[model samples]
Target chain A: MFVSGLGYIIGETFKGLYRNRWMCITSTGVVVVTLLMLGLFMLVNLNIDHITETVKEQVEIVVYIEDQAAQEAVNDLYKQLSEHRQVEEVTYVSSEEHMRRLQMQLGGMLEGYDSALDNPLLASYEIKTVVPESVVELAEEFETYPAVSTVFYGQGYVENLFAVTGVLQYVGMALMLGLAVTAIFLISHTIKLTVMMRRKEIVIMKYVGASNWFIRWPFLMEGLLMGLVGAVVPLVILYYLYQYSIEWVAGNNLYFLSLLPAEPVIRELAKYLIPLGTGLGIIGSTFSIGRFLRV
Target chain B: MVEADNVSMKYNRCKQYALEDVSFSISRGEFVFIVGSSGAGKSTLLKLIIREIKPTAGLMKVFGKDISRLPRRRLPSLRRSIGMVFQDFRLIDDRTVSENVAFALMVTGASRRDIRKKVPHVLGLVGLQEKAKERVCDLSGGEQQRVGLARALVNRPSIIMADEPTGNLDPGTALDIMNLLRSINLSGTTVLVATHNREIVDRFKKRVIYLDQGKLIGDEQKGIYTHVR
Candidate 1:
């Protein structure tokens, strides 16, 4: 009985779709536009997150050791840096290696120090941090350690990068929210037109003793279908567009403007688009039903 | 069964009461008539009994429940037990006779087997069994009214209210419709006909409630219409 009831309601919903052909199409079209914009912004937002992560990876800290530091101090400093949770990677530069690099940088100008018994240059440890912001505290803490001469981690650049990325994430979220809300109202208004056209049928249903839910099911189903269809179309469009754009960028060899892998991004977006579209559509129809379906 | 006690109503448009101090009770298995000229509060009184509109003063009851104060959600249950027929028939033009009859049962949550079983039985009672698949729009007025009757009778309701059921039919078709109502009444379901048809009222010789200027002027058994203008 329940099965038949659902079948009947579904059948009725389709009948209504056919009966109000233009209105259903118009509402579905509105959903398509809304979900498409949502997809576009979501893609942009994800890529921004990816690019910021890449930038964070490039940030590093350099700690110069004093020339008078003993070998035990150098070994101890290497162990301390490795044990810290935020230190992702560390490379040591001996005084001898520093002198060689200096020689390579300035041809034969550094050849005067080639046979010197005591080296004038300092040894250093290059530190890559897991979190970009940790470099500030790491630099301060390193300055307090004995045998550490100086620490420079480009503090100003790291802070500015983080701040800009934080704002972009927030702005992206706000834009998506605004568009979803606008789509809900637009879907609802169009469904309202559909409801108005069916007012007589609703009145007849009331007179014939139809339960409120029984009467409401068909409209709800219609709204759900509209939302699902609307969401799916944009995903298909976005899939092709995203694939083409990703390939276009790869073909141009523009590695600096790193785009996140397209497949996972599309898969991730599908999860949200379907539900978001349907939820908005249902909300719209519910309001329309409330406004027009007066008993 | 239905009862009214000092029921009065005045619509928003006028200070004059549509029905004033009207009191009556309709017993089970009785065929009753509410006779009045146009604007004599016939429709208003019917609307009050159906609880379609509330009476401004006093109480009304149907099936032993205080219907004037019945909550909106409970109204459908009340309405389900009573079948209503309008002068214009009110059948969906696009539906076939079987679909129209089934529509009533479908809304009440009847299974397809039950609807299929009951629709034909009710249509058979109205003598429209052969016209089950025919579209109501394609039928004659008499046939269309029969479809309306079949829709009303599908639920086998305890009471049937026809507000001028014959108002749109020719004399021959009107008489046929009256005969159907009479047969339905004979089967022990209460019937209430609101009409100014003096001929059928006299012929049926049933209990009659007469209204004039929003007041009950007479309640008689086996009575005919007698008020002039």
Candidate 2:
């Protein structure tokens, strides 16, 4: 009997959909488009994070040591820099190696300046910080070192990256929220139309003393079915777009855009989509039919 | 059994009384007819009995319980004790005849075993066993009325309030339905039928309550449809 009831409900839902074909189709289309736009923005945000992380990983703080600094003083500075919690790795570059690399880089400009052995470049300790905020603190701390002449970092550029990504995250969230609300509203109205067409049946059911739950189940199921169906196209679109993005980044040698692993994102999305679609469907149907079923 | 003591129902903030100071008692296994013309408060009295609408004054009781004070939540159980057959034969169009009859049992949480056993028996009682599987839409007006009767009797309520059960049927079909109701009342179910069918009233000669413009004009045992302005 339960199976028969379920089958009857499913059959009736399809019949209702067929009767309001234009409304159903239009609502589904709206859901798909909104989800697609939201998904695209998410992908873009993920890639941006990947690129920012790669950039942060490459940025290193170089602390130049004074020319007259003693060997022990330089060792003390290195220890202090390493003891700091923010430092990931510390590498020492002697003044001679620094001058050799400078000479190699400026080979054409410094061709005849060989006798000018005043290689003002100092023995530097390159420090990699774990987080962006630590870079400024580490730079300031290095300036207090007796062996360190000056401490400089690309703080301006890093701050700009942080600010831009923060704005993007907010914008992405607002856009997704707006689109979700609109999609739910449209789907609810569509289900309302379906309910209106069967108002006579509902009225009879109520008069016959059928409980509110019994009357609500079939319509809720109908909405859930529509939501599930509506989600399919957008999920497929999102999957292909993710795959294309991974491939494009990999092909372009954009190693920076690899923060979100493709497999995990896809897996997480699959887990989220089923429940999200079902919930949206149920909510839309319930909201639309709640007032009408009050009797 | 049903009892009403000075029951009055007013609507729209006491501007009009649908039923005013009406009082009557119906016993089990008795057949009574509430005879009234259009707008004579027949439906309001029925609704009050079923506890679908509450009375504005006085006390009403059904099955030895105060119906006027019954909570909205308890109305379902109260209604279950009284079978109501509407004039329009409110059978769901999409359901088969057997399903329509089973619905009454279904709402009261009757066991599936009971439904399977009893639905066919009630349909058989109403002489519609052959048309059990046919959709209600396929049945004629008279057949559909029979289906409604079958549904009402399936639960074996002590009282049946039929508001014009045969209003849409021809005289022949209507008589058949009346005979069916008489048989039901004979079998220990009190039947209260509200109709304006003077021919049925005069022919059957059952107890009748005559009403005019929401007022009870007369009550008689085995009465004829006699009323003067």
Candidate 3:
């Protein structure tokens, strides 16, 4: 009984979809456009969150040592910084390693400086704080050390990045939520119109002793189909577009910024967007058919 | 098979009553006609029996159970036991005759094998076996009503209530439909028809329940369209 009934319901759902093909297409289009906007915002927000976290993790105070500082003073300073409660780690970069890094970055500049005597770079202690926000106080303390020649931690830029990313997250979420609500409303109205055209059939079904569930199953399934199509279309389009974006960023060598990887981001987006779209479709049809069920 | 005791129904927010102090009992296998002019409550009484509307006052029972007190969940079971035909021959016009008939069985969770078997048999009973594949919209008014009858009978309900089933057909066609109903009744399925067609009502000479101004004016066994008292 259950198998036959399920077959009947599925058959009816397909029949209804064909009967109102234009309406289904229109509703599916609405779902696609809405989810696209929401998905784009979600991707952008995720990437933004990734970029900010990367920058925050790189936040550290670099204290350059004086050229004449005693070896004991430098060792004492490194041990003290590592023991500090606010510091997570302290790595000492010798002047020779510093000149080698400059050679790698600048490439060909000071190429003849093969000996330590020609290396003008000072040895430094890099301090990683437990909290990125505590870098200001830690940098000030490091600058007061007698062996320290200079202290730097990208103070203004780091603060501004954190503040900007926080606001962007909230704004993106609000916009996505608004788009979702609008999509549900528009899709429901479209399904409502389709159901209204079939009101007589529903009444006839009721008169023939069909339970409410028997009549409702078809419409619900149709809604789910429309939603699934809507969701998958945008996901496919976004997947390719996101992959291209990551490649474009890499190809252009925009080294100051990095995007979240395409595969994982798109996969996570699909996980949420598909269910949301299908759930919206069901809700739309359920509410649309509610008024006609009175018969 | 059916009973109504002092039933009264008034539409919501309306002062006029649709059915007032109407009482009648239809036994199993009985062929009964409810004859009355428009707004005389013939259709309203049929609607009441089908449990479409609860009476504003008094008790109504079908198969010895008070339908007025039946829970909403059980209404479908009550409706399935009684088949109903409409004046408009209400059917899905785009579908074939067989599909329309099969729909009645499908709703009650009948198996596909059962539908495949019963649909052909019911179509044969209505003499539409050859036209089973034809769409309902393409059939004549008489043929459409036959399709309606086929749909109503496929469920094998104990009672059949038809509301002006032949209102759209000519006199000759109406008489043919009436004869079909009579034969169905003779086969031991209780039939209740609501019609104002005096010719068909008189020719049957079966039980007639007369109504006037929402009241039961007369009920006579072996009666005609017009009752002399």
Candidate 4:
């Protein structure tokens, strides 16, 4: 009984949608635009995560050693750097190893001038901090070490990166929420007009012994189809655009930004956005029909 | 099939009542007329019997069951046993005559085979079988009321309550509808007609319950419209 009734209701809903073709298209268009905005914000979040991972990887402080420091003092400084609370890992490079690294960096120009000229490169401890933002404060602390000559961390760049990401996260969520509510209201308002137009049908149904649920089923189906159309169209367009974005970034070999690969990210996004769009459609239709059902 | 005792309905807390101290009972297969002019609470009485509004005071029953205490879920089944026709005829203008009649059966969970069979039978009873494929909007006023009557009877309810069924028809067409309703009543379906049509009320000479200013002033056996102008 339920299956056949459901089939009938679905057929009726299809008829209703076709009858209200202009409204359906306008409603679907608004839903697509709003969902596209939501998709863009999600992309922003994914890329922000990617950028943070890269920045974290490159966020170590380098402490250069005093050239005339005693061997014992250098050993003590290395031990302290390793044991510091903020230091994640510390590696000590001897002056000879540093000289060899410098020779490699300078290429053949600085090669083969060894012990007689002495190792001019300073020995350093390469430090990785637990938090990228802590690099500056930790670098200052390392400068107080007895054998440390200088501490280097790009403080302004690190602070600005963290600050910008924090603001972006806040603004992205606010815009997404605001736009989502607007979409629901807009879609439901349009559906409300359709419901009003069909009110005579509802009154007739009520008089003829149709249950409230029986009347509601077709409207619910209509809402679901509209939502599916709205969501799927933008999702396909977003999928293609997302693929193009990844390819463009890869083709340019852009050093400033690194996005996660398209295959997993777009596929993962599909798993969430499609259901969300459908849910919003249901919600919108429910809003439209709520008052009418009370009669 | 319906009972009421000292029933009253107040639409507002601070306003006068729509129905006050009204009491009546209706038996199965009894053709009755609730006769009154405008503002006599005739429609309000019907609405109360259908549980459209809870009586502000006293008890009302349908099919020997107290309706004031009936559960919300049970209302549909109660209404299914009693069909309603409105003054406007309330046909879906967009649908064909056949579909309009079939809609009544479909919503009540009738099988497709039953709908196909019964829709034609009821439309034939209303003498609109030839016009089954025509949209209701294309039908004349009398034809449209016949379609409404077809819809009301398709469900085969024990009782049918019509509010001013002939209000939109000419005198000749109104008499034709009255004859159709009388035949249905004779065939053992209870009928309640709420109307201010004086000539039909006088000519039919049926059981009449008269109301004036939300009060039941008289009940007459084979009564005519007795209100003074």
Candidate 5:
């Protein structure tokens, strides 16, 4: 009995789709466009997150040591910097190493300062905070140390980068949400039109004792099929697009511009997109057919 | 069997009742006609029997159960036990006659093999066996109503309520539908028809329930259409 009932529902769903093929195709196209925009925005947001994370990792606070500070004071400052809860990692750079780095930067001018006795650069501890936003606060704490001469973490650049990334995340999320609502609205209106066109047939069905579900199953299935196809099309398209973009970036040696790897992004998008698409479809069909079922 | 007692129905915010103090009971195997002028609430009474609308007051029962309070989930079973036909012939025009009939059985969760066997038999009963493959849009008015009848009878319901089943047909075609209904009634399936076709109603000389202005004015065995003043 269940098999035959299922057969009937499947048969009716196909018949409904075939009969209204043009409408189905138009609605499906709408879904495809909506999902494509949504997926694109999602990918952009994901890549932005990756880029910001990499940039944040490069932000380091350098606490310069006073040249006259005693060795024990320097050791105490280093211990304090390491024990701070917000600190992720700290590396000590000897004055000699600092001079060597300076020499590499100003090659010909640093030839006279190669000896440790003549090296004028102060030793420093490079501090990395667990969160980039706390870099300024951590830098201030280091500045209060007696052995620390000064602190620098490129404060202006780091703050501006964080602000921009925060705005990008919010805007991306809002746009995706708007697109999802629009997609649901479009599908719902299309389903409404189909339901209106079949009003008489539904009346007949009701009179002939078709249960609410018997009448509803076909429209629900139609919506589900549309949503599934819509999600799959964009996912396939985005996967290849992202792959090609990644390959192009690698081929051109654009090391500064980071694109997230293709596989994980596509997989994550698929995880959410498929269910969302299908859920929107079901909701649309359910709303459109609700009034007619009261019979 | 069907029964109604003091059943009244009023549309929202409206002072006038669509039906008032209507009382009737139909026994098994009865052929009854509800004859009245337009706006006399004939259709409303039929809709009440089908439980499409609940009576605003008093009690209504069908198949010995109070359907006025029947739960929504159980409505399908109640509706399945009673077949209904409409004035518009309410057939899905794009589908073939056989498909139209099979839809009735399909809704009841009948097997495909049962539908395959039952559809042709019902179509044959309505004398549309040869036209089973023809689309409803291609058929004449009488033929379409016959298809509607075939759909109604396909499920083998004990009661058939038709709201002006012949309303769209010419006099001759209408008479043919009435004759078909009468024959089905003779075979012991209870039939209730709501119509204003005075000529056939008088010619049939069957039990008639007459209504006027939302009130029952006359009911008699072998009654004429104009017996009520």
Candidate 6:
């Protein structure tokens, strides 16, 4: 009996779809457009996240030591900088070594200006901090050190990147949510119109004493079928587009965008698209039938 | 058996009454006719028996259960014991005659084996066994009415309520259907038919309840259409 009921429901759904071919096609088309737009937004958002992470990894703070410090004192300052928790790496550049490297790069251009330097440049240790935010605190801490002259890093660029990425993530999430709600409402209303057209059949079923579930199951199944079809076209189109775009990026060596790896992104999209399609279908069918099912 | 005590039904905030202070009882194994012209509350009374509509005031009992207070969820099980036929011959257009007959049993979760055995038997009883494979839309009006009757009788309910079962049929086909209903009643199922066919009333000579303007004006045993011309 259960098997027969299931068969009957499946048969009925197909019969309904065949009878209203144009409406079914139109609803599916709407679903495809909605899902495609959503997929595109998600892809762009994922790439933005990857790019921000890459930028964060490369940002570092540079610390400088005092000019008059002795060689022993400079070595001591280097050890102190290395021992700091926020410091990634530390190196000491002597005044004489720095001058020699500059002269090799600009030998004849700087020959007349050698006597102008009454004082030698400071022999400094270059310290790289692990985190961009820790630069200010490190600079303040280093200022208290007797062998430290000054500390500086790109504070403005770091703050601006964080703010911009934060706003982008918020806007992306809001847009996706709005699109989902609109899709659900549109699909549900379309299915509701279909139910309204066949209300005479529903009334007869009710009079014949069909259970509410029995009356509703076929329509719900129809909605599920609609959702499945709607998701399929967009999913296929988006999947190929993602693959092609990733291949293009890889081929042209556009590494600065730092896009998400293709495999993981595709897997995540599959997880989202299937359920989203099913939910839209089920919700639409339910709303349409619920109006007439009320005894 | 069916009984109604002081039943009254008002609609749209008591501005109009469909059935007013009506009371009657039908015995087991008896064939009863409810006769009246249009707007006489015949359908409203039938709807009350099937629990399709509740009375605004009064008590109705069918098969010893107080149906006036029955929950909506329990109405289906209650209705399974009572068969109803509509004037329009409300057969599912997409279904075959046999499938339509089997639908009543299907809703009650009857086994396919039982449906296979019983559907043919009921179709034969209704004299539509040959046309069982045909779609209802393909059948003539009389044939469609027979299909409706076959569907109504498939479960072997204790009582059958038909509202103008022959309203759309020709005189010859209507008489044939009346004969079929008589045979069904002879098989020990109580029948309540609501119609305004004076010829059928005179021919059947059954107990009749006559109503006018939502009021039961007369009741007679072995009665014909006795209201004034």
Per-candidate total of colliding backbone pairs: 0, 0, 0, 0, 0, 0
Predicted candidate 1 versus true structure: per-residue lDDT over A1-295, tens digit per residue: 6324768888888987886778889889988988898898899888988898888788888899987889899788889988889989999987788878878889988666643587787789989988876888888988888789999888688889888988988898898789767766776677677777777667767766776777888998898899899999999999899889889988999888898887899889989999877876677677777744455
Docking class of 4: medium
Q: How does residue B190 of candidate 3 score in lDDT?
A: 99
Q: What TM-score does model 6 score on chain A?
A: 0.74
Ranking by lDDT: 5, 3, 1, 4, 6, 2
Interface CA RMSD, all predictions: 2.2, 4.2, 1.8, 2.3, 1.8, 2.5
Across A1-295, the per-residue lDDT of candidate 4 in tens digits comes to 4324778887778877887778778777877887777777777677877787687678788899998999999889988988888888998877788777777788899756764476667878899988777887788888888989988777677778778867876776787678667766766666666677777788778777778888888888887887788778877887788889888988999867788877687777677667766776777677767666554
DockQ metric for all predictions: 0.41, 0.21, 0.50, 0.52, 0.59, 0.38
Q: Give each model's whole-structure lDDT.
A: 0.85, 0.78, 0.87, 0.82, 0.87, 0.81
Candidate 1 vs candidate 3, lDDT winner: 3
**Model 5 C-alpha lDDT per residue in residues B151-185, reported as the tens digit of each score:** 88988889988999889999999998898899899
Please, what are the lDDT tens digits per residue for candidate 3 over residues A92-200?
8998888888889988876786747677889998888998878888899889987889998987997787688678777877877887677667666766777777888
**Per-chain TM-score, chain A, candidate 1:** 0.86
Model 1 regions more than 4 Å off: A1-23, A79-89, A93-122, A134-141, A281-294, B8-20, B29-44, B51-57, B68-77, B87-89, B111-114, B117-146, B163-189, B193-229
Candidate 5 residues A75-171, lDDT tens each?
9998998999999999999988887888888879856654667877889999889988898888887889889899999978988988888898788
DockQ score of candidate 1?
0.41
Q: How would the docking of model 1 be graded?
A: acceptable
- Superposed Cα deviation of residue A275, candidate 2 (Å): 3.9
Q: Which of 1 and 4 is the better model by TM-score?
A: 4
Better of 2 and 3 by TM-score: 3
Off by over 4 Å in 2: A1-60, A85-120, A127-145, A183-237, A248-259, A270-272, A280-295, B10-15, B35-40, B68-75, B109-113, B166-179, B196-204, B210-218, B223-229
Q: In model 3, what is the error at residue B23, expressed in angstroms?
A: 2.0
Interface RMSD of 1: 2.2
lDDT agreement of model 1 with the native: 0.85
Question: Which candidate leads the pack in TM-score?
Answer: 5
Using TM-score, rank the candidates from best to worst.
5, 4, 3, 6, 1, 2
| Per-residue lDDT of candidate 6, residues B28-126 (tens digit) | 999999999988989999998988788899898899888977877887777777888888999888679998888787777678789999999999988
Q: Docking category for candidate 3?
A: medium
Tens digits of per-residue lDDT for model 4 on B102-181? 88888888888888889999999999999999999999999999999999999898998999998999999999998999
